[model samples]
Target: MARILIVDDAKFMRMTLTNILTKANHVVVGEGENGKEAIRLFRELDPDIVTMDITMPEMSGLDAVKEIRNEFSDAKIIMCSAMGQQKMVVEAIEAGAKDFIVKPFDENRVIDAINRVLG
Candidate 1:
């Protein structure tokens, strides 16, 4: 099981991901509300992977992915985007996120992403 850090502005989104990950037997190391917290949590937790929301108050997930990957080149990140955020999702991938999950997440897709990234 991988240790995961979930960063999202919506509490429900974070909780949803937490449930999905936990049910899949993955340990959630931490949860954050924005990109800034994502960076800090990455430093402190050093989780196996991170699920980052694309937009937030302080910093964007794209920026966070860039920052984290700069420091930890092998940092594994998965961008989470809402429908129609395709452009941002592509940019996130370019920023070094390993994979992505669309909003109103699919359980199988989420698990598949984690497995693929962790694998």
Candidate 2:
């Protein structure tokens, strides 16, 4: 039941995330197509959690994670990536991501990641 923000470039990915999180009873506070908007909305909305895409236009999720963590050290962020982004995933974890989820996401995995991050 945490407030969550989803940041991803692809429309269908966003939609899939929204549906999955919504169905699990999490309030999706906002969705963004790029890291700049994601950062802006994260500050404005102050969600409990954020799911960030590793690759996106404008700003990369790694950069956004850095920026957000720069301001909000206590921020709860989950990095989402396609398989095989080991280096990026490691960087994101170092940048303060609570967890990472592999895409073409599974509903159960998504929910589990959310719960683990929130905890």
Q: With candidate 2 superimposed using the best TM-score fit, by how many Å does residue 22's alpha carbon deviate from the native?
A: 0.8
Model 1, residue 83: distance off in Å is 0.6
Global fold similarity of model 2 (TM-score): 0.98
| Candidate 1 clashing pairs, residues 3+ apart or interchain | none
- lDDT value, residue 76 of candidate 1: 97
**Candidate 1 global CA lDDT score:** 0.96
**What tens-digit string does per-residue lDDT give for candidate 1 at 59-94?**
999899999999999999999999999999998899
Model 1, TM vs. native:
0.98
Residue lDDT tens for model 2, 19-56: 99989998988999889988999999999999999999
Give the top-scoring candidate (TM-score): 1
Candidate 1's C-alpha runs over 4 A off are none
TM per candidate comes to 0.98, 0.98
